[model samples]
Target chain A: MTEQLVIMVLLSFLVVIAFGIILLKDLLVAVILSGIYSLTAAAIFVVMDAVDVAFTEAAVGAGVSTIFLLGALTLTRRQQKQQKHNNYFALLVVTLTGALLIYGTLDLPGYGDGQSIANQHPQLAQHFLQKSEDEIGIPNVVTSVLASYRGYDTLGETVVVFTAAIGVLSLLGLRRRKREEDPELDAKRQCRQQNEEV
Target chain B: MKYLALYNYWIVVIIMMAGFYIMIARHNLVKKIIGLGLFQTGIFYFYVSLGKVDGGTAPIFVESLEAQATVYSNPLPHVLILTAIVVGVATMAMGLALIVRIYEKYDSIEEDEIKAIERQHWQENNGEFGISLTAPPTASS
Candidate 1:
C-alpha cells in the first residue's frame, strides 16, 4: 500500500513536471525543468525496478542533454517568442491523434500481465533468460541479451551513435579548411568555441 | 479492477499525447526537439511496463537454477531501451548541433523567421536557391 502511495506521488510529480515543460514561456526555465523531468522519470523508473534504464535516463537525459540544450541556447534566444499565428490547426490534429491513441489503448492488455501475448510468446526471450547463465555466463540477463543474443543490434546501435556524432561534428565542430581560408573568421570562431568550452 | 490494472498504461498514453501536442503546437525548434525527447521517453516507459510482471523481481540471476526459476521481469525491453536511450541522446546532440548551425546562418532560430528568410531568398534567386541558401548574407557578398 505504501509502495502504491509512493508511486502515486511520483506519478503526480511527473505530471506536474510535464505540464511545466509545456506551459513555461521561458526557454531556459523549460530547459531546466526538462532536466528535472528526466530526473523524476529516472526516479520513477527506479521505483519500477528498471535500474539500468533509470541510470541511462539520469546520465543521458538529465546529464548530457541538459548541457547540450544549454549549449544550443547560447547560440539562440533564451525566450520563446509569443507565436503570431493561431494553432487551432495543430490543436485539431493533436486532439484527433490523442483520441485515436486512447482508443487503441483500450485493446491493450493490462499492465504487468504475465500471460499477455508479449510475455507468453517469449520464444526468444526465454532463450536469453533461461540459458544465459550457461551460454553467456552473465548474471544480468539484460547484459547477456544485449551483448550476446542481440549483439548485432547493439553493433548497429553503436554505429548509429557514431554516425550521429559524425553528423554533429560536421555540422558544428571547428573546420580546418574554413579556418585556413579566412584568418579573421578563424579568430572569431576560436573565441566562440573558447566561450562554449568554458 | 480493470481500470486500476490499466491505469499505468493510461498514464503512459496521456504523457505520450502531451508530448505529441507539444511537438505539434510549439513553433520553437528547440521546444520541438524537447517534445520529441519526451515522446521517446514515453515509449521507453511503455515498453518497460510491458516487461514488468506483477510479482517479478529484477532480471538478475543468482547461484542456483531453482532460485532462478522465480519470476523475473523480462530483460529484453530493458536491453532494447538501453540502446534506445543512447541513440536518443546522440540524435538530440546532432539536432542541437544542426540548430546551432541554423542559428549561425539565419541569425534567428524561430521557425517562422527561418521560413521567411528562405522565402526572401527564393524570391531573390528566382526559386533556384539551394544549399547556398544557408550561406551567411555577408559570405554571399
Candidate 2:
C-alpha cells in the first residue's frame, strides 16, 4: 500500500516536470529540465519494479542524451525565437488527440491485473517463462527472451542504431579530417562576416 | 476504486500527451528532439505498466528447490523497451546532427527565420515561390 502511494506521488511529480519542459522559454534551462525529467521517470520505473528499464533510462536518457543535447546547444542560440503568431492549430490538434487517447484507454485492462489478456495468455510469454530456465538455462527471463527468443529483433535494433550512427557521422563529419568543410568553422566565418558588415 | 485501478495507465496517457504537445508547439529544433525522447519514454512506461502483475516480483530467479511457484513480472515488455531506449538515443543524435547542419546553412535555427530565408532565395532564383520542375534548356544542353 505504501509502495502504491509512493508511486502515485512520483508519477504526479513526473507530470509536473513534463509540463515544465514544455512551458519553459529558456532553451538551455529546458534541456536541463528534460534531463531531470528523465531521471525522475527512471525513479518511477524503479518503484514499478522495472529495474532494467530504469537502468537504460538512466544511462541513455539521462546520461548520454543530456550530454549530446548540451553539445548541440553550443552550436545554436541559447534562447528560442518568439513567433509572431500563436500556434492555436497545434494546440487544437494536441487536445483532440489527447482526448481520443483518454477515450481509448476506457477499454484497457486495469493496472497490474494478473488476469489481463497479456498475462493470462499462454503463448509466447508463457513459453518464455516456463521453458526459459530449462531451454536457455538463464535465470533472468528478460535476458533470455531478448538474447535468445527475440534474437532477430535485437539484431534489427542494433542495425538501426548503427545506421543512425552512420547518418550522424556523415552529417557532422570528423573534425580532424577536413577543418575547412566543417560547419562550426563556417559559422565562425559567417560571424566574422557579419561583424565586418556591421 | 475502479479509477484507482487504472490510474497508472491514465498517468501514462497524460504524459504521452504532454510530450506530443511539446513536439508540436515548440519551434526549437532541439526541444522537439527532447519532446521525441519524452514521447518514447512515455510509451515505454505504458508497456512496462501493463506488464506489471499484482503481488509479483522482478523476473530474476532465486536458487531454491521451491522456486517454481514464484510469480514474476512479465519480461517481454522490458526486453522491447530496452531495445527502444538505445534506438531513441541514436535517433536523437541524428536529429541533433541535422539541426547543426541547418543552423550552419541558414545562419539561424529558428524555424520561421529559416523558412523566410528559403522563401527569399526561392523568389530570387525561380522568380516565384514554387519549385520549377521543367527546366529551361541551358546553353550546354
Best by DockQ: 1
- Over A61-113, each residue of candidate 2 has an lDDT whose tens digit, in order, gives 99999999999998777887665567888889988987888788888887788
The DockQ scores of all candidates, in the order shown, are 0.49, 0.46
Scored by TM-score, the top model is 2
- A40-137, model 1: which lDDT tens digit per residue? 88987776767888999999999999999998897677988677566888778877876787778788887778878776665766677678889999
What candidate 1 gets wrong by more than 4 Å, as runs, is A1-4, A175-198, B64-69, B130-141
Q: Write the per-residue lDDT of candidate 2 for residues B10-32, one digit (tens) a residue.
A: 88888888888878887778888
How does residue A64 of candidate 1 score in lDDT? 95
lDDT (CA) for every model shown? 0.78, 0.79
